[model samples]
Target: MGRWLVLGGTRFLSRAVAAEALARGHEVVCAARGESGAVPEGAALVVVDRDVPGGLDALRGERFDAVVDVARMSYAWVRDALDALAPTAAHWTFVSTVSVYADAAALGQGVDGPLVPRRESGDGATDPEVYGGLKVAGEQAVREAAGDRALVVRAGLICGPGDGSDRFGYWPARFARGGRAVVPDAADQPAQIVDVRDLAAWIVAAGERGLTGTFDASGPRTTLGAVLDEVAAAVGAADLERVPVAPDVLAAAGVGPWAGPSSLPLWLPASHVGIVARDTAPAAAAGLRCRPVADTARAALEHERALGLDRERRAGLSPAEESRLLTHP
Candidate 1:
């Protein structure tokens, strides 16, 4: 069995990776502040703050076959982790985002797509507009520290059970409610979403195989309408009414795209159509497999029900906003 070290393992993808590694009989250690949630049961938990003085001291002198970093956003964080664990870990896997690309809407853009310019300064709070650039900086840090031993996975929208983002999960949970759901007019627009489980499993497998280089980790290309259909089928919402509203109308009404409160999940502006239609052929050839959209939707619905579907969500349109859009559009 391989020895694995997982950074930021208390929630979402990091937690999933730790769980997958443990299930495969690997010796896993998760280092993070235990506030968000607990790590998977079997993995050893090491509580350490990565922001304070000697925060990474807990990882000093520890050796692992592979290290998967899921929460490094700043250049400093990546550099610090590399300094502490570079000599001990043989392989370093950095979980990056597709946001690093400057033009995801461009046709044929893959891992070689033009990346956003690196931030001028690594200090201060990361500007939301330059989030992608910051990620680029972090990627560079990993490559500089680990050299050819580094593996970068540029992930798209991550969904499925345990997703707190609510971007891809919104449709499934909305369909379960059985009512007139507000959907975008661009139904045929392609969309890409990777299940958290699938992404975690692939990362673990790749690390074990000592895979290097970068890969665009996303799911099979699908359309928003097709995804909604799958969600309806999964939830048995045969009579669900999909109110198709024009993209401009939604945008005029202040409905943001992709994620966050008061936004329509998986719906991007016209200019960013290429973001959802990203090419996943390379990642697929690299052993990145995605589960069916139906399975993802169903699992998300079940999770939402457990979490109380009526509760306020961090993403997706609120019931009142949906009502306004559906009734007035």
Candidate 2:
């Protein structure tokens, strides 16, 4: 078994990766501030704030076969981790985002597509305009630090259980409400999302095999209508009324695409459909296997219910907004 070091392995994709590594009998060590959540059982935890002084000092003298970094949002974070662990870690895997792509709207774009220009500085603040640029900078930092030992996985929308973003989870949770739900008019618009568990397993497998270079870690392309159908089936919302509203109308009503407050998650504009239709053949050839969309939908619904569906969500149309749109339409 390999010795693995996972940065920020307390939540979502990071947590999944740590758990998968543990399941594979690897000795896993997770370093992160224990604010968000806890790492999987059987993994050692090192509490440290990556942005503060002596944050990475906890890793000194520790040797790891592989290091999976899922929480490095800025170039500084990557640089700091490398400074502390590069000599001790043989392999480095950086979990980047598809947002690093400059033009995902271009058809057939894959991992080889153009990337957003790197940012001048590595500020960790979350700015939507510069998010892609920041990620590009982080990727570059990792590549420079680890060279051929670096593996970059450019992941698209990650769904399934423990998805706090609620982007892909919104569909199944909305369907569970069992009423008139507002959907984008573009029924055939493609959607791309990979289950978190699937992504984590693939990352671990790649590290174990000493894979290098970049890979687009997105799932097979699927359509918006097909996703709704799966959610309907999973939630037993056979009688659910899906009100397809024009994109412009929804936009005018103050509904934005993807996650964040007040946005209808996964409902991108018509021009951005290619974002979800990204070519994943390269990743597939590298052994990325995605689970069925229905399975993801069902699992998301279960998780949402466990978290209390009636509570305020990070995504999806608010009940008031949905009611207003349905009534006005």
Candidate 3:
């Protein structure tokens, strides 16, 4: 194994990946603007403002065997990163999202079926609405820079320890609370979430395998309804109300987690199953193993509450509301 460098290493996914690398005895270098997340002990730092002049450029002299990029949501951001570290690493693993898939009113789309078009030009720059497109473009940038050496692992909602984003974490923690739970209209809807540790395992393995091309790193297919019940059961909670919210409500609510009352057809219908619509064929071929949703949920709640990860807090709902939700049957 060669020296490994992680961009945004102090963040959720990056830290997990860096930890795995450290455990493997690979020379690990963790870099971020500030000390945050779960930074592995004894890892070197490449501190620089992501927006400052030569901020990223400061690391030009440093070289690594591979780089795991968990940040850089925009194409320009990724471009600058590639430019700065182009000469420092051999294998580049760019963490992208499955949202790159074309808009599907209903989730059940396949990776090979039709790809979500990327906004290559126009006002597409740095727009949150264009996050998926931006990621798509960023993937292209890595391809251009590292060529066959780049591994673009497209992940779905990543959960597990240190999960900064509580999108999925909220479910388990809230479900355990046992209250009048307001869920999306379709509880049967499928939602995909990869455990942070599982994702880190694959990325490190990919580097060792020198795997290239795009691979989808996500957990096995599961539904929101099942996940909720498991979480509720885990904490010995009962009585649940299924409040349904509509997509229009989600839109009208002005964004944010609680705004929407419905799960949307994010994933529904027996044929296609639940909400996670992206294809993980590429990743499965490269070897990505996912544990059961029950295990994933259990660990998420335990870890977050015990560790109080910043990422999980980002999606945390009110404890009072949670208590109220559990009142439902």
* Model 1 poorest 10 in a row by lDDT: 120-129
Quote the lDDT for 105 in model 3.
42
**Local error of candidate 1 at 232, Å?**
1.6
In the range 80-163, model 3's lDDT, one tens digit per residue, is 778888666788999987666665444545554455567544344345337777777888888988877898887877877776
What would you estimate as the lDDT of candidate 3?
Answer: 0.67
Candidate 3 Cα deviation (angstroms), residue 53? 3.2
lDDT, candidate 1, 87-192, per-residue tens: 8889999998888888867744788888889863453233543767777887888898897899999898899999987777788888888778888888788788
Q: Candidate 2 overall Cα lDDT vs. reference?
A: 0.85
The count of backbone overlaps in candidate 3 is 26
* lDDT rank order: 1, 2, 3
In order of listing, the candidates' clash counts read: 0, 0, 26
lDDT of candidate 1 at residue 54, scale 0 to 100: 70
Better of 2 and 3 by TM-score: 2
Per-model TM against the reference: 0.96, 0.96, 0.80
The per-model lDDT (C-alpha) reads 0.85, 0.85, 0.67
lDDT (tens digit, per residue) of candidate 2 on 1-329: 99999998899999999999999999999998889898899998999898796689978758999999875456677778888987778899999888787785776687778887887465445664377787788788888889789899989889999998877888888887887888888778788889999999999999999999998888988887787777778775767888889988988988898777778888787666667888889889888999988898988889999998887888888788889989886
Mind sharing the TM-score for model 3? 0.80
